[model samples]
Target: MCTWFYAEKATLSPIITKAQQLPLTDTIMNTMARSAAMSGNIRPTDMAAVFAPNKQGNIAVFPMIWGFTVDASPKPLINCRIETADRKPVWKDSWFRRRCVIPASWYYEWGIPPSEVGYHNA
Candidate 1:
């Protein structure tokens, strides 16, 4: 499972602004800039800018915590596989009802490092 993600404000900002028909406020832009700079990787518990439907069903930017918590584990659940999401107890409700779009360029997998696994840019 991937617990880390990356979002580029430069790419996300325009889409959000256009959707809302307004420029992103300075505060929101500054916050995103700082957060992205503080850690290139956005991990569980980190605040992230995500897109979700509002009451009117219009997409909007919102600050969201990166994961879901469960009693069975000390760490939060960051990823839910589609194959098991509906069948799994922990993800059942959210899978059916709650949803949000995370605008991430890419994510890192757990365990073995990419370099050790011989991954390289083409």
Candidate 2:
């Protein structure tokens, strides 16, 4: 499962502003600063950049906490398998109706060997 994702302000700024035409106001800079404070390792409950549809149905950038809350879990849950997302009660609605994209330069998955991981400077 993907437990963490990376985002850099320098890389995302262009996409957020030039391509998406969104203004990089002070509020957005603050959000970017928070992401940087984590060294781009955005885990569950952290403020992460997400691209989701606004009320106008146009894609917009948002700083969102990166997980879902469920009574079944003691903490927020972050991973949902695509195959089971539509079938699972906790993820069904979000899978079908309220989908959003979490922007990342890359992701980190647990249990993988260092040699096989993306960070390995092979």
Candidate 3:
């Protein structure tokens, strides 16, 4: 989603620490190091460049073009249902190979009443 997400500083500490340990080429290391210095938190938009994939199935030392979130007329897609992801054209490819985890302390869900039931009281 284009809407900025919240990530706890505590949760990001370990990930940034580990990224620093990665054996990136001098160029890549320099870029990330600079960005990290400027911004206390690493932005996900810059991750593809820092942790790109290589032809040999290894992490590339250089950054690459990362997918960007778009602000469409409709609300941005914040969540995708795992069950229908494969069938959806926009997400099919990324779902298969470019999957990434979103760490969150909490999530939101909506409740809908059963259509068949006229009314139910507890």
Candidate 4:
């Protein structure tokens, strides 16, 4: 489950302006600027900010941080099982306090095959 998500530009402008006044580096500032510039116009996937309110009631917008994934760990966490998530250590904190929602027109799910499969075969 996503404990936080980015809001639409109309809802995020004021928050973005406030974030600009903070003591952030040039890169951070630039990214925020870019995100604000693209807000409401681009696909959500292209936005750079994490549009969620923090503990202080302020929006927790931040620059995109990069990470890597390994082929060995192929399965990705696209969704969390809401039923048992609260009991899990990794997601308990976010579930309790920082819960967030991502608005979408539709969502996609894939069906599993009964036999072995590979990228090429699929």
Clashes of each: 0, 0, 2, 0
lDDT of 1 by residue, 1-122 (tens): 36876555455665434433423334544664423231245777666667888889898776666789888998887658899999899999988887998777667776532342344553
lDDT of 1 at 100: 91
Q: Which residue pairs overlap in candidate 1's backbone?
A: none
Candidate 4 lDDT over 1-122, as tens digits, reads 12223235555666545543444424654764443342332332233344557668886655332111235554323356789879976567767886443332222234322221222223
**Model 2 bad stretches (over 4 Å):** 15-39, 111-122
lDDT of 3 by residue, 1-122 (tens): 23233334354555445544555524554664444321122233434223445678776334332233545524335456789889887678777787444433222233322122232343
Q: Compute the lDDT of residue 103 as modeled in candidate 4.
A: 35
Give the TM-score of each candidate.
Answer: 0.63, 0.66, 0.40, 0.37
Which is better, 1 or 4, measured by lDDT? 1
Candidate lDDT scores, in order, read 0.63, 0.63, 0.43, 0.43
Give me the displacement of residue 74 in model 1, in angstroms.
Answer: 4.2
Q: What's model 2's lDDT at 34?
A: 35
Model 2, 45-91: lDDT tens per residue? Answer: 66665788989999977656667877888788876788899999899
Pairs in clash, predicted candidate 2 = none
